[model samples]
Target: MSTGFKCRNCGSNEIEEDNARGDRVCMNCGSVLEDSLIVSEVQFEEMGHGASAIGQFVSAESSGGATNYGYGKFQVGSGTESREVTIKKAKKDITLLCQQLQLTQHYADTALNFFKMALHRHLTRGRKSTHIYAACVYMTCRTEGTSHLLIDISDVQQICSYELGRTYLKLSHALCINIPSVDAFDYLICLLASQYLLERI
Candidate 1:
């Protein structure tokens, strides 16, 4: 009799049965499996789909798997698998900038949070993370009223301004929204408002 087993490595269920029948190896994932191990059909399918989704997310970044999310508690990977690799990469970048530029931790946190929020919004509407990250950084610098030029930010992020500009154009084209012109004066008004609100408290 032939029995089925799920691959622990790749979450693939179409494991082939060996002639010995004592043990099995997953053809898709190359994981060793035993007939005694039982996994629910739903769990196997979910883990498989999750792995595929994460793989897509990681490949979205231009840099090779520099964006690997640690495995999670799901059927195969570790707990961190639920989070996207791009999100973690953004956080690390923000932290590095804060350390190098001597910016306050609060500013770093705010920048990271804004990037996360913007990326999530655009992605849910069918945009890519890499495009969003580049845009988010530009928007962040503008919104924060930093004297640092766009070229400087691009250099620091190791993203070419030309590539980022092209991505911005594509994102704007896809979203059908104009990239609003950033005004340094407008940012000052925002900062003043924030200070006033703090004083009132």
Candidate 2:
């Protein structure tokens, strides 16, 4: 004899028995339908078969089936060490490039953060690390109101300006970063200042 019980919350018939909690829960809405009900017998039902089976429920955890977790071919260390190494290397590269470009420390840190985001998005795959670093710096400068031009970064990195521009565009589009337009007056001011300093020294 079976008694029909409907969930008061969702009125769902898909109820599951929680033996540990001694409660009947609605699987649909996760509401407790019946509580503190004493169960006389627990029957284990085999999956893919309609009839109930009189056997103990074997846990995959106890059977050693779910013991080991792996990352297939991508496991480098135990956990997260490989990812940390990649980040460290990227930071070092960015720092060096920033020093070469005479960027301030704030801009360097900002560029490092952007490079980390690009790495997380897998945008650095199949591309040279130098190009990614250069692009990050370029984008950071543009977004932070700095006057560093793409040609200036390309000249310092000894890479083609076209390649740096392409990578910058790709990074901007992939990351959805809205970089502000470069002010022509900023460039003119920088050039004039540099010429004056050169003439003085």
Candidate 3:
């Protein structure tokens, strides 16, 4: 048997499963209905595949280059000597994408670098970047006390927290390990705050 719910938005009779909330959004409106549902691993994988495809689509359209290109290779400074190729995914370009979206390159770069380093730490330890990035960004704003919302991140990355969360789980399973720091986000916020204070004073 199946169950149905009412949308808090338009009171629609039909709702689409909202993977993030573990239920679904209204077919007519886009209101979250269920907020306590857990997704299956299979569905998680499929979402990942879909997100990757979308990322690739965006990449192909953007002048930044094509997606699924297996990360852009570049040298880190000085005269064009030996180059080091860093392999990252289209999702890794969140920083650039966000900046492009907001038209704020400087601050966007700072945020991006922060996310990249923080994400690298988490992912290296066997966590998922997508999830960490989403959570970290949210918590980072909270810590820094900024007013950025998960929706903002969603717009920039073209992925939602629910989807990102699932991706994180799948990536975690594949990596085979668990992250131990729940305070990294707060720590980063404090660190950034202190830096700002120093710059001001």
Candidate 4:
């Protein structure tokens, strides 16, 4: 934009505002009268995907250069995952394991609580998440008296029975949970007579 205002430096009547370059300049004298004049106007357009934001979000605290403020690649630990990601993955694995075992939502929620307790206590460090999650589910079953077998969880996820037992024991001790011993007849019923078999019979 050409202005009738004269250049303060050269005293020439050739002042121009360059919106594209974001500067007010003396065209003839090649002197910058003002700088850091960022254009704030934005036009919104509708697209099939969504409403498109044509301009970048500028921070109000930024003094110059139109600095944008937002999160980029949230990372923690190994830089590939954040706390939310770990928790989400744990929940997904627990849910999938619960589904495989045909357990209820209440059981799944109980297992998730166990997992969170383990996490808070730092019992999850240097250990496999799936193992801890499976242990949590097993503990849930034991506490709720749901008659689920640790072997069933191990079978569905291809985990070792010993590892699940170890994790179960570790979680129980650390969390101070006192689950009573399951009956031998309960094991026999679960092993010899499956839910499907009982339904069929």
Model 4 steric clash total:
0
- So what's the TM-score on candidate 4? 0.53
RMSD of 3: 19.8
Residue ranges of candidate 1 with Cα displaced over 4 Å:
1-78, 122-134, 168-201
Candidate 2 vs candidate 4, lDDT winner? 4
Instruction: Tell me the TM-score of each prediction against the true structure.
Output: 0.40, 0.52, 0.30, 0.53
All-Cα superposition RMSD per candidate: 18.2, 18.0, 19.8, 25.0
Candidate 3: TM-score? 0.30
Q: Give the poorly placed runs of model 2, Cα more than 4 Å off.
A: 1-80, 183-201
Candidate 4 weakest lDDT stretch, 10 residues: 73-82
What's the lDDT for residue 172 in model 2?
74
**How would you encode candidate 3's per-residue C-alpha lDDT over 24-110 as one tens digit per residue?**
544332234564565434321246435222112123365432223443453211221111112234234545554544534444433
Model 2 — TM-score against the truth? 0.52
On lDDT, the candidate that comes out on top is 4
* Clashes (N, CA, C under 3 Å) per candidate: 7, 0, 3, 0
lDDT of candidate 3? 0.42
User: Which wins on lDDT, candidate 1 or candidate 4?
Assistant: 4
Model 4 per-residue lDDT tens digits across residues 93-144: 8998899899987778778767765765688998898889888888888877
